[model samples]
Each structure stands twice: as C-alpha cells, then as structure tokens.
Target: MGNQPSVPQPGTPLQVIGAGLSRTGTASFSEALRILLHGPVYHGGTQLTLAASSEIRPLMDIVSRFPPQNASEKKLIGNLLKQRLDGYAAVTDAPFNGLIEELVEAYPNAMVICTTRDAESWVKSMKSIQNAVTMGFLRFILFPIPGMRHFPDFVDLMRKQWWYLYEAGEPLVAETYYKHIDYLKRVVPEDRLAFVDVKGGWGPLCKALGKEVPRDVEFPRINDSQAIDRLAKRMVQEGLKRWSIGFATVGVVLMSYVFWK
Candidate 1:
C-alpha cells in the first residue's frame, strides 16, 4: 500500500477521528460517537469552555502549528497532539476539522467520520456562532473579565481555522464550505472515510464502522448556534466569581482594621 496510515497499537484509547468543520452537525456527531463508542468524546467547543489557563497555553501552541510544514514537522505535530489527546475516544469540532489529514495518520486505526450538511446552511450557522462570541458587546463584556485573557489566542486560532479552508481574498462562505468538504474527501481514504449527514441518522455511519445501529436511541440533534454564548457566559461567570472572592477577602480585612481603630 502507498503510505497507508500506521496501525494503531492494540487497545488504543482513541478510535474515532472526526474530519468535519463545526456547525456541520459536529455536536450531534460527537454525542452519537460518545454513545456508539461508549467513551468520552473530546469536543472542541465544550472543551474550550472548560479549559483553564494551563490547558489553553499549551493547546494554543499545538493548534497554531497545523497543516505542518514537512514530513518531519508533521510527525512532530502528530506526537505533540497524541500526547495530549490520546486518552479520548473521539475528537471533533472546530480545530480537529482543520487538522484532519494529520490526525488520520496520527491515530491510524481510528475510523474517520466526515460530517456533512447543506453548504449555505453551514455558512450561515458558522457566521451566527462567530458573531455571537466575537461581535457586539460580548467582546467588550468578555475582555474585561480575567478568565478571558487568552481571548486573543482564541482569535488567532479562529483566523488560522478560517484560512485552513478559506482565504481573505476569496472570502466566499458557501464556496469555503464546499472546499472544506472536498478537502476531507480527498485527504482521507475511501475505505476509512464515512460521510455522515446527521439527518441520515445512524445507518450509514454504523455500517462504516461495522457498528450495530443503536436500538431505541435516536441519533442526536444539537443546535449549536448558541454554543458560543454558553461558552462565553461560563468564562465570564467564572472570572467574576474568582474576582468576588478576592474582593470579599479585601473587604473583610479592611473592616477588621476599621473595628480596631
């Protein structure tokens, strides 16, 4: 075979590789994989929501090195990612879609599932989520919070994600959507790839993985347009909560001095 992906070691923890962009049913896709694989799935949106400074610092560096420069570089990037993510049963959403080719080689035995949807709808969905988190008062409100100090790093990652399937000059949303799907289909091998539209439900995906259709379990349908709002709110609330703890401590100390006087 011509440079087939290396066989994963026996009992490799990660088994599902998602080669799809966010807003392409990725949330629902992640849930279905969690159910089917019977293990926790690493979702980019949710993971980022819960990430602290320590996690983001390293992950930011790792994600920024995508579409690796050469074979040696690709190998280095793959090792770095697997070191961090090898424990998860599946990896999906935003940046994973951006790193499909490298992930396939890194996690060789993992079945690749490329989530699909209407291109125009995908474009609109992406825009709504981006605008929710980055535009309007959300940015101003979010930036003042201490927890969102890594916000600039997130913006950098987003820009990199966009250029992975897009260019500033072209900037055609629908066209970019198609290009991403086409890139996935081209990059992943036919035998290893499954094109999944969550609308089609479980049959095609199950067949690709040699899995039984889950009984009494309808395929998941998650509306992720508001996912960013939830992520942002959590960050802000957490920051303010920590700030309040410090403020309260200071107040108690000042009151003690006043009472002594």
Candidate 2:
C-alpha cells in the first residue's frame, strides 16, 4: 500500500453532525441516536484554544473575519475536532460545514447528519441568543466592565459592531444557513443526510436513520413563542414605568434651575 487511506469496515456506526440553531434539539437527537446505534457520542465539545483561558474566563468573542468555508481555516478546525472525537462512535452539534468540513472530510465513511428547523424559528432563537449576549455585556459593563474595560476604545468599537451585527446579521446568517444545508444535502446523498425537524416525532426519525426507536426516548420541547410573548409584554410595561420616572426627574431638574436663575 502506497500511503493509501483506510476505509471503514462494514457495520461501523455512522457519524452524526447536528447543524443549526442553539436550541434546535441537537442534544436530544444525539442522545437518542447514540442509544439506538449503541455508539459513543460526543456533543458540542470544543478544544481549548490559547485565546480561551482555562480559568474562569468569559466566552471568546470571535470576530469571524471570513466566511466559514475558507478551506484552510476549515481544515484546521476540522483537524481539531477530528482529534477530539478520535475514538468516539459519533459526533453532533459541531458547528456548520464552513467551520467543520475538515472533520467531515476526514471521516468520509461516516454518515453526515445535518438537522434544520423552520427559518423563522431559527431566527428567533438566534435573536434570543444575541439578546442574552447583549444583556451579559451590559451587566459586565455595570460591574465596571470585564474584558472591555482593559481597552475602552476596543469596547466602544465592539459595542458598535455588535449593534450593527445584531440588527443586520440575522438575514445574512439565515442565507448562509440555507446555502450550507443545500450544499450538505447535495453532497452527502440521501442515505447519509439525516434531514430532520427537531419538532418532528422520534419514531419516524429513528426509522429513517436505520435505528430502532428507544423505549424511553424523551424529546424535550423548548422555545415556545407564546411564553416569550408574555415575557416581552412584562418587560415593556416595566420599561415604560422606568421611562416615566426619568422624564419626571428631568423635568423637575430643569424647572428648578430656571426658577433659581
């Protein structure tokens, strides 16, 4: 053999890749499939980077300067993930193809599972995540700022960037997601593409993936819109009260200054 690559033997369990929004049931699917297939499962696992402190450090604010599909960068990320999942029977929720093609390419024999949900729901989930991140930033700033205080200018720049992205980024992300899903579908063939809606029932999904339904497979439903709407209305009412108080205080201060002068 002249540096020939080895192929997976018959009956080796497939590799499952869960791609999509944060709350889209990747974890649930992975767990269910793992039990059904009788394989080792790794979920959303990340390798430590120099930028990510091993201590009580905050999340790394990656300024993705390039689109995820940049071959070389994708290769590096893929290699890192491949190394992490070396002995694992399957992996899931490991970012999109742009960020993970290398890992997929390396394990060509494994099944490539890509999951997606409704676009509107995906956008909402993304919005919720961004809002949480923004709130976290505000809380950190109120606490005299965390990583940003070290560089005031950088913080200001970051805030501006975040605002711009948060407002304008969703459509772009949605477009990219659509394209990536299409790409995976075209490339991986029907047998490998585990096209599934997390909202869907577990029995059919298990059948599609060549696995027996787990006796106790519990698919946890989350991110209901009705619940979010109630929370939003409550926040708005509180906001209006705060605004009213501010207006009253400003009016009193101006009136006092005029009378004294």
Candidate 3:
C-alpha cells in the first residue's frame, strides 16, 4: 500500500456490495437495493459526484495510484473505503465493479450481488447509453469549461477504472464482463454471493438478501438511454446559460471601462 490512508474499524451498517458493471441494470438494482435494505444505496452518479468533491478528492487520487490487477491493491482500497464510506448501506456500478474484491474484504460478511446480462445485450445497452454523439459533445464542449470540467474528469477516471474508455471493440467489453463475473465467483464465498440477472426480477434478489418481496411495488428500471441523453442535453444547456451570463458580465465591464476612460 503506497501512502495508504489509515484504516477505520469495520462496521456492519453497510451490508450489501453490488459487483455489477454498468449497462447491466445497475441503476435498477441500486433502487431495488435501497428499497430492500431500507437505506441509501450508492450508484455511479453518486460515486462520480463524491470523487469530484474537494473533501473526497483523495478517493480518485488513491484510485490512480493502484494498478487494478494487483491483488494487494484490494486490501489497500478496502482500508480507504473504511474511512470514505462509513454510512452507506450498499454500493453499485463503476467503481465498485472495479474494486469488488477489495470491498468484499472490507465488508467480509456483506452480501455480494453480481448482476449480469447476455453479452450481446450488455454490449447493445452500453452502446446505447454511451453514444458517440452525446459523449463527444460533453467531452469536447462542456468538459473544457472551468466549472464543468471536474465532473467529466471524474467520469473519465471511472471509465478507465472499469476498462470502458479505450477497448478495441464490443467483444472486449463482453470479455471484461464475463471476466468480472468469474472473478466474483472465485473471490466471494457461495453463501455470501448472489449471481443474478435483472430480467429474473425480485425473486433471486429478494431470496439472496433474505428480504420480503414487496407485492405492491414493481421493480425499478431506470437510466435508460433516452433518459441519459435528455440529462446530457439539459446539462449542456445549463452550462451554456452560465457561460452566456459570464460573457455578458465581462462585456458590460469592458464597455463601462472604455466609456469612463
């Protein structure tokens, strides 16, 4: 562990660790976990926002310091989480997928949920949400600006951690997906791990977690491609609005100075 932070005492409040990749119904699983556990569940957006915050900036720094393939890196990451995420009941998506082994070590008794889908379907889902047009627009336009830059940077780091940023093709992503699943199988004990498909719905999940399946509420399915696209467009519009205001203020100041002179 290089310059490792102090490890806090293990706590039992965080009882679930989702070792699922994105585009594998992580968004849905996150919501369901929250409901099942009756507590907050951390997702990719949450992780990204946390990574960008000044207080939690060290999380990303620590991530950059470790090579993903290093076995001891998991222990180091587990120690870091002991300090960083004390109150969360569960976690899902990008960063967790990358650090499943570490998290399992951190919360040894926590239930590990490995949600997966068919490789072809997973690839399709990833391509749908990570469309070139939307991602390129954000990467080129909003991310270059001062205030908006941190978020994209954080997301980029997460993508790199998940091996999503620069793979040769879809097959690589599919391969990584299966690799993660296999890794989970190897690391997590049989009783502690639950391998599931989102299409299987609440039965497997509820059974795994030993939670009562709510009869009235349907399972959640969130963060679809259309929803993500809309969110990106909204963010871009907001960035433009702020930039326009800044430009107008500068123009007014320049005009006032010239007139007075």
Candidate 4:
C-alpha cells in the first residue's frame, strides 16, 4: 500500500462487473457496456489511465493484503471498492479480476459477465500482447538504469497486479485463468452471472443484460497484438525521451556548477 487513507471518496454504485481475464475481449466488452449502459465502463486501460492517484495504493493493498478467507478484510475491501470504483457503471480486466468476490459483495444486484476464449487461444494471445508489452517496457525503460526499475504509474500498477503476481510461465498462467473462471462460477449466482465468448457477439451478451441486441452495429473486436505492440513501442519511445531529458538536465546543472566554481 503506497498511502493508506481511512476512507475512500464516495461514488455511484456499479451496475456490471466483468469477471473476465485479459485476451477475453475485455476491451470490446468494455466498449459495448459503455454504449449500452450509457455510462463509464472501467477496463484495464481505465485502471491505468483514468483512476485517481489516491485510489491506486488502496487497490494494491486490498488485493494483496486481504485474502477472502479473512473475515476482517471484508470491511476493508468494501471501503476500497466504494472509494475507488463507486462511479464506474462497469469494471473489467487487471485489478478487477482479482477483486470479484469483493465486487459482488459491494454490488449484489449488479450483473456479472465472465468472458471466455479457448485456453489455447487465450495463452497464445497473452504471449503476444502481455509478454511483448512487459518486455518492451523492461528493455526500453527500466533495464537501462539499475536504480530506475519502478515503472510509470499505470504500468507499475499493471506490473504488480499481473506480471509480478503471475510470472511463473504458461502453466501458472493457465492455472490462474481457469481458477478465476471457476471462482466466479462458484461465487456468483446463476441468475446474476453470464458466461460468454466474444465470438457469440451481441446475442448472448444482450440476452444476459436483458436488453435487445442493437439492430445494425457489429460487436467490437479490439486490442489485437499489432495494436498492443504499437502501444508498447510508443511507451518505450516516450520513456526513452524522458530519460534523455533528465540526463541532459543533470549534465547542464553539473557544467553550470563547475563554471561557477
């Protein structure tokens, strides 16, 4: 926990909770949910880019500190959700996957959507997107400087939540993925939960949400490997630029001091 606050800021209650793992069309589902619900939908991208700075520590603390088995942690979990996730109508990916139990407790009436793809496909996608992104960040940003290993805020959160926690390799990845799905199945009520594949498109999702399928719009398919790789490269370039600027500033300061002396 970076900074522990006693209470979180109030926010609107959530209406939908996505219990899906990454590479399971979470981005597409987030887009669709935003459109259908006519409100903000939190995704991994949202976690990285949009969430308030104060919220991040509590999120990390809650996930790492409070295992569901501990009865005392429930209140802390509720407080964390209310503080961090109150206004979002829906939440998916990264941090949210690890908080399903707490989310369901906080929003008992909200629908749960568990997106699935074949495990083989999911693993393949993860290798391309997740691994590539992490490696790019490491190679171009952190590895160059021994003391500068901490990532930028969003990437740091992701590193803690995803990569650091589950870096054992493919077997662990598969285990965590299936374990998440199984946990949702066990915890959420049948009526409140919907298991779907992105390929099922609007039919299953719409039916689950009790809304009519949109007449003409095709379902969204986003965050392919190419796009993710491009983002990774952009991040690397940006980090390198920042590092260069810092070095230049330091050199200028040192030269100015020597001249004055």
Candidate 5:
C-alpha cells in the first residue's frame, strides 16, 4: 500500500511523532517534551489505559487491527489516531512505537525521535514492566467494571504490537529494539529523525528539536517500572472501589424487591 496519509489532515497541529518503545527512557522523554512543546502530548500506553470509557472502546477496536493489512486499513488507523492526537504536540511510548512507519509517513513534517538506552539495560527494565503487567493483571482486576470491560482488548493490543518480544524473551527484546532502530534509520530521512538517549541529558534532545538546552530545568529521569507499578495498584484499587459501589446498588435493589414482595 502507499504511505499512510503523508500529509497531515488540514489544520492538524501535531509537530512531533515519537517512534520509541517504553523503557527507552520514554517517560522522561515524554516529560521533557511536555516542557519543550508547552502542549499536551498523547502518551501511548498510559493514555490507552486511562482513556474515558467512550474512548477506550473505540481505541480497543482500532488497536486490535494492528499492522494494517491494506492501504484502507492504514488510513483507518491513521485517521483515528490523528483524530485523537489532533490537538497534541507529540506522542510517545508503546503501542505507537509499533506504528512508527505509519506515523512517520502520516505526518511527514513531524520530528521523529526514537528514545534509546543501553540495550541490556533497556531489556532488563522492559522485563520488570512486563512482570508488573502480567502478574498484576490489570485487565482482569478491572474487567468487572462496566466502563473498563474492554481493558483486556487493550492488553491484547499491546501484546500484538510487541508479539516478538512478549511471546519470546529478552534476547528477542534486544533484537527487536535494534531492528526498530534499523527501520527508523532506513525509512526516516536524516533531517527529521532524532535519537535521544535521555540518560545523556537534555543537550542532545534540545539540539535535535532546535530548542536551546535549558540550563535551569533538570532533565527528568522517570523510572517507568516504578510508575507502572503504581499505576497498576491504582487501577486495582479503582476496580475494587467500583465493584463495591455496584454491590451496594444491587443490595439496595434487593432490599426494595424483598420489601415490595
């Protein structure tokens, strides 16, 4: 199929497209972008996890059709994501990392930055996040909530995007990273593509985006493992709280039924 809508939809404001996976210092990079862009950014996985019920449902359907099979499929995915991302300055992190090519082509002018870290270190961090996700099972915990019933589909979407790494193991995870890097190098033009290893601090990123390095602001170093764990715990608490409300409502209904009976 032809490139996925190379021209941005009319009046679209997105200026950056991130083709980086989680644990590639993506959290820190995202925070940095927030500082630089002075606008909202569509952070990939986290947004999907916490999106409104109305949004989560459509997002689930869209993501489940990954690796778009045809040009039309590509447009469908691109148009929907663009609609969601229209107002944002940029997007970074998981699932979207899998859509790097499409996004690169979709918004030809957007700066494409691939967040990078030492491969071994990145894979180790990735495994920790994977454990947090799998053992914690955020989807299962939240499934009972009417609003979050489609959570499993979101998980499935991530799984499909990272099938090579998730289904296999670390060796493949490292391999996948390199392969992605190679893809970026091959497909993305030199002028627009930037590789930011956040550990190196803000200089590299600042220079890439044509923004002077901020002497006052300390570069963010968000440990995603800790962040993800906290998120899972919060979601679990929310789920249980919702279940309690549902039970209380049912109890009230049952009491009324008995009284009327």
Candidate 6:
C-alpha cells in the first residue's frame, strides 16, 4: 500500500499540509471541515529549525494530535514526522518522498489541498517581507559603525531568496507552490485532489470539498503581503524616529555632563 490512491473513508478527520502559500484554502477548508465533519485540521505554522529541540516537539505534537482514526492515519503521521525532522529531508535537495508519503496517506480519506499564486506576485510579496526584515537587521548592526552602506533594491534582496531556494535545490519551490496540486492529481484519485485558487472564494471550494458554503462565514482572507509590507514600512519608520530621539537624548545628557565637569 505504499503506492495506492488516497481515498478517505467517509467521516474521518482531514489533514492539510504545506507552508501557507500552498494556497490549500486552509481557513475555508478547515472551517468547512469543522462544521461538516468534526475533524481537527493541522496546518504547519513555522519554519523547520532542526537545531532547536523545542522546535521538533511542536512538529511532532501536531502530527501526533491526529487520532489514529485508522491504522493508515497512524502510520502516515508517524512516517511524516520521522522524515520531516531528519536532517537530509529538511534540505530541499532531498527527495520530497517522505512528506509526499504523509500527505498521500493522511489525506486519503479526507480532502487534501495545495495552492500557489502567480509567480510574479509571489516574488513581489516575498521580497516585500524580506526587505523589511533584512533592513531592520542591517540597521541594528550598522547603526554603531556610522559609515556602512545601507541596503538598496528590495527587489534584489527578494531575488536572493529565490537564489537561496535554488541553492537548496528546490529552485522551483516558489514556481511549484502548486506542485503538490500536480502530485495530488497524479497520485491521489482525480476526485480527491482539489486544485483551486483561493481568490475564487468559498463557493466553488465548498462544493469541491463536498460541503455547502456557510452564508454567515465570509472567506477570511489573510497575510496579504502587500498590505503587510505597507504596515511593516510604517512601523519601521516609527521605530527609526523613536531610535533617533533616544540617541539624541542620550547624546545631550552626555554633553551636559561633560560640560559641567
């Protein structure tokens, strides 16, 4: 049964995997699951940091949270955590088989979803976030030196993330944010895989998941990087102003002390 179609038995919990960008229609899908079926859906929230022992527990716990529901779900979740934390599998260069296996097994009796936005849009959003983070970091390190060059071209910084992706050997990581969609198409039965755009909203998705859309629940959109970037910039500007004022105040106090002495 290593190689079998993902056919979920009726009335079992659903599992959704992948980074948020996978566009699996998680909130809508999860909301639908919670309403229609009492299954607890688990989505991965943080980057996998192999160094922290504390980090591994969260990953393991999330996987373990799924009640064995069946022998298959039990084994699938087990293998998923094993492969996920293994050093080699954490790198993009490693074949994606382990994670793929978990997805296939866990999602068999349940609807599994994966998604990707347009490449250009993904790159733009990624760059905006990266720029804000890197700029903040650079300011901290360089503020003391006084002559260090500041960063230029947030786009270039964004490009570096793509390069890092390539170096990690999953160069197509961004391009194939929807790769799981293809995987689900090829491996899981056509009826099971729901390859869809989140932008299309809840109606089509509810129908695909075999549930009726709730009229009361509007699709809760999240993490729009464009909006996030705008907010990050505003916060950064405010932080800089605060830092500048603090520096000036300290400098004035030092001068007064020196003059008085």
Top lDDT prediction, candidate number: 5
- Per-residue lDDT of 33-151 in model 4, one digit per residue for the tens? 76677676767544542334444555556666545457667767777776666667788876777677778888888999998998767876777655654564464584333323333
lDDT per residue (tens digit) for residues 1-261 in model 6? 001111223444334332224223333433444444444333232122112223334444433334446777768675665445332111111112214445566445545444445765655555554555456364663333222222222223334433433332222445444443444456566655555566777766667666677778766565444444554565456557667888999999999999999
User: Lowest-lDDT window of 10 residues in candidate 4?
Assistant: 1-10
Output the number of the TM-score-best candidate: 5
Give one digit per residue, the lDDT tens place, for model 2 in 1-261. Answer: 001112223444446655433445655555555556666555542211111222112112221322334777656555555544555566664233333344457677666666667765666665653453345334333233233233233333334433332333432356645665665655565665666776676765675667766676575443334333454344445545556777799999999999999
Name the runs in model 6 displaced over 4 angstroms: 1-12, 15-40, 46-98, 129-174, 177-181, 226-261
Clashes of each: 0, 0, 0, 0, 0, 3
Reference-based lDDT, each prediction: 0.72, 0.48, 0.67, 0.67, 0.72, 0.43
Tens-digit lDDT string for candidate 1 (128-153): 66665554444544554543566666
- TM-score of every candidate: 0.80, 0.54, 0.80, 0.80, 0.83, 0.46
TM-score of 6: 0.46
lDDT of 2 at 94: 28
- Residue 191 in candidate 5 has what lDDT? 89
Kindly report the root-mean-square deviation of model 2 from the true structure over all alpha carbons: 12.2
Q: List runs of model 4 lying over 4 Å from the truth.
A: 1-12, 49-55, 133-175
Return model 6's CA RMSD, one decimal.
Answer: 11.8
RMSD of each: 6.3, 12.2, 6.1, 5.8, 5.7, 11.8
| Residue 194 error, candidate 3, Å | 1.4
TM-score of candidate 1 versus the correct structure, residues matched by position: 0.80
